[model samples]
Target chain A: MNTYTNRQWIYSKRPENVVDERHYSLQTTSLSTTELKENQVVLKSKYFSLDPYMRIQQSALETWERPHPLDTVQGGAVVGQIQDIHPSCREFEVGDWVLSYTGWQEYAIADVSGLRKLNRDEVPLTTALGILGMPARVAYFGLQDVGQPKPGETVVVSGASGAVGQIVTQIAKIKGCHVIGIAGSDEKTKYLKETLQLDGVINYKKFTTQKEIHLELKRLAPQGVDIYYDNVGGYITDAVIDSINTYARIIICGQISQYSDGLDTPNLGPRFLHKMLYKRAKIQGVLARDYNNRMPELLEEMTPWVQQGLLHYKETIVNGFENLPKALNMLFYGKNTGKLIVEV
Target chain B: MNTYTNRQWIYSKRPENVVDERHYSLQTTSLSTTELKENQVVLKSKYFSLDPYMRIQQSALETWERPHPLDTVQGGAVVGQIQDIHPSCREFEVGDWVLSYTGWQEYAIADVSGLRKLNRDEVPLTTALGILGMPARVAYFGLQDVGQPKPGETVVVSGASGAVGQIVTQIAKIKGCHVIGIAGSDEKTKYLKETLQLDGVINYKKFTTQKEIHLELKRLAPQGVDIYYDNVGGYITDAVIDSINTYARIIICGQISQYSDGLDTPNLGPRFLHKMLYKRAKIQGVLARDYNNRMPELLEEMTPWVQQGLLHYKETIVNGFENLPKALNMLFYGKNTGKLIVEV
Candidate 1:
């Protein structure tokens, strides 16, 4: 039997604001190669998905469901290589690449039931944690079923350069809708406009006041926003909502801006209630996990777009297992341009 | 030709905060028996529905569309007597009772195209302005379609003693839901519990802190609220949202709490966005006018409930056209238990 040293991040305490090292303790542990249980696989982490949703998990809000026990490893989507598999695990081989919602650790003994085998050669294996995985699925399912972007309609996406937002913007464009991307940085706006060919772009960081954001939104969506894909909820969502057309659809997948602030986060605004009524808008929150049953359908629709050069993906990789805390914080500071990941 | 003096409430100016006399001018106008124009009928107001929606008309907010001209008669739903009809109008005759958005006036030269003929004997003529009219239809359509209350689902209604709220409570009860009603006054909660037979009642005015309201809601909706019929959007809504269950449906028919305060109204609080996401809830704003196409269908379904004495309708009538402003203001102060109307 072979023994190996494994580095793991354990939840220490709930975060008060933005997460830091104080919220977690990285400890070196040892694991010995042992006989695998039936239908179980040994997973060696290749890449850890750094997402704003990770910040939600560290928060103390009761609404933030703890999928794992406290003081256990902090959990995230991990693209891993199967090290050893039980004889009963027929779906996966020892060398097969896969994705699992395994916690932040160098190695994990995971049930095959939660593992999805990945075809690494077709695209980057890290995409199993990103574009071809959670983010793309969220973009496809939320926009198709929730936003329902239609031809000639105006669609505004906040966090427009983030993993899910970028995909949502492209999908809206592919559907023939006029896409307006709202990103925090000029570089992000440029990427969305120059690379993605979004119909319009708003650099939200350039706006100082709510009125400024509202004016910019009105300028970009002259016919009014028919669909809003909300990745960041705060003043950006407030401004987009202000310009919504009749029977508009608002797909609320994330509120990254408020994740750190928790329940004390201010609402979109006071007029949000009235604006909703007058516009007769529909606002719904979507969880990609809930739509995993339709992942094959999502892959069918989105894979062609990527292969044909219609969809482009971006990655912001932070190297090493030790950089996990800093990588997670990058999401809060808007330092990451697209999908943020930590390579182990 | 006979001439008569008629009093009319005209929109004088936009309200600064809550609507007041400065926003309206009671004018003594004159109407004469003259040959009617094509599609024009002379209407004598019998009962005027002075609703919270009228306050929206007086507000300076641009989103609240003024369907009628300002400095003219203040528009509202009115139950009227057809004193004379244009010869070209074959659908209505003199002495017919009908419902029309004829504004706050004793007489209006209305277009026959906008009138809905009413059977005065089938129900109280004023019921055409209350239960059997817009309020009831709003309750029927919004609850049935938007809320989608399932049997045994926990349903909560804010402003539960108001026109539409009371009806929504009854319909939710009939649908076999565990009904919880929240109102501004204790009397309102008592009526909802004793007369309406609601499963639970929360007197919102009794709670000084949001925590108190939240605790009470937790006690009442032990399993969490599945359906929320939002008639008032303020702290009460914040409390209801706090207790919402997964896949909750929020039917946003009215936000009477903020109609007076306009855009300055405080939000349902910061936690609302996260709660919606965690619960995968649906929040939709509904206008009864949008459901007019389904009016006959709604009436068909609800009429039987009313006839069988399964649904009880209540009205707060303020006699005379001079009291129009007073009657409309009652809705803002939570003075009216049910539908607020002015008998002209």
Candidate 2:
């Protein structure tokens, strides 16, 4: 009987503000690979996906799912290679790269049915955790389906340097839209303007108030914002909403700005629903999970674009199993320019 | 030359709070009927529509249109009789009842193309101002088109006793929805529950806080709210939003609560866009003017429902043109049961 040592990051405490080491505890367990059940495979996690939604799940209130049950393996997606497999698992071979929702663990036992075989020859294995993963799914559908961007239309993306926003900005550009990206730092804004070739960029950190941000948006988008893709939803959302043109579409993909301490006890902002009435606009919330069944549809188009170098992406990798919790905490501080991932 | 003494309520000053006589100046002018232009008819205003949107336009900020220009007769809908007609005006005849956008004046010249002929015998003449008029246009489309209420689904309406809201609640009931209404006073709640036969009614004034109101909604709607028709935007909206179910549709028809003083400087409310992402909900704004071209389609269905008494309505008529501004102001106080009209 062969055995492997598995290290797991257990979510111990619920977070009221930012998630840190105090919220998670590392645990070591021994797993016997010889006793694998039918259709099960032992996975050695290579990369862990860190998302803002993890903080939202740690909230005391009920969100998309019931507060990702406490004292469990910190639930998340992982990109890994199959170390061992049950004899009944004929679909996959040993040493095959795959994507699985096995969370932050050095080794995880997963069902063969739950694993997506990753072809490293096609794209980098890390791309499975980002450009072709959940972030890309939301950015593709949220912007294309919900936003329905038209050529010559103005699209404003908040958190424009983040995982989802970067893809959203690129897709908007591909759609021939006059795209504007709003980020927290000058480096992010610079990348969005120079690399992403965005029509406009606003470093929201420079603005003291929502009014100042709104003034900057007004100066950049003189014709008015046609579609607002909001990820950071605090004062930045308030400012972008004020600049929406008549019949505008607002896609609420994420509220990273409010997820920290505001999910349970929401922060107060000025009511701007009157603007929706005046503009005859529509605001729709989009989640990547909602399009989980449509991943093939997404890959059919996105896969080709990614291969052709038309779809640009960046991953800020934090190496080491111990830094899993720390990497998630860094997301809230706007330290990562793109997707934040922990590599084991 | 035949002349009529036209008393016009010129919007003299913009109100920071409630609109009143102080904001308007009543001027007497002699309009000559002999000077009617081609395709123009002389209209003697009988019923002046006092709506919440008037207050929105009075705001210093630009709404759907520019702020209602100062020192001009306040723009509004009027149900009146054609006293005289130009020789080339073939559509309208003298003494015919019609609806026109004639503002606050007791008499005005209207182009034949701008008037919608109202048959007083088919329904009450004032029905042109309430059930079968602009209010009904928004109510029908806002509820049916935007809300898309399904059978057995829970529908909650804020400002449930107002002109548009009354129609919305009834239409929801007709669509086989379990309708709940939220209103200011017990009298209004009684009307909603007993008169309209809603599945539930919440007297929002009884609850001092949003949490209390949210708890009341939870008690009333155990399955959760699927559709929310919001005519009032404030704490009532915040509470109802908290009680929404997955895939809920929120119709922002009017924000009467914010129009008085909150329009220019919006009041603060807890951010709830995070809930939208969790529930995959939609919030859309609908205006009657946007459906103006589709009035015939609305009338085809609504006109009969109203005539057959299947669709019920009420009107709080305030007599005399002298009370025009006061009647408009009374809406903010929740004094009117249904459509508020100033009879000249």
**Maximum-lDDT candidate:** 2
- Tens digits of lDDT, candidate 2, B233-324: 99889999998888899999988889887888989999999999888999999999999999999889988998888887889999988988
What's the lDDT for candidate 2? 0.92
The iRMS of the candidates, in order, is 2.8, 0.6
Tens digits of per-residue lDDT, candidate 2, A1-344, equal 57998888999998888889999999998888876899999998999999988888888777788888888899899999998889999999899999999898898899998999999999899988889999999999999999999999999999999999999999999999999999998999989988999999999889899999999999999999999999989999999998889999999999999988889899999999998998999999999999999999988898889899998888899999999999999999999988999997
Per-model chain B TM-scores are: 0.95, 0.98
Put down candidate 1 lDDT per residue, A118-213, tens digits, no spaces.
886677797777778899888899999988777999999999999899889888888999999999998999999999999899999899876799
Question: Which residue pairs does candidate 1 place in steric collision?
Answer: none
Proportion of native contacts in model 2? Answer: 0.86
Error of 1 at B283 (Å): 0.9
As a whole number from 0 to 100, the lDDT of residue B12 in candidate 1 is 78
Where does candidate 1 stray beyond 4 Å?
Answer: A264-271, B264-271
- Candidate 1 chain B: worst-modelled 10 consecutive residues by lDDT: B262-271
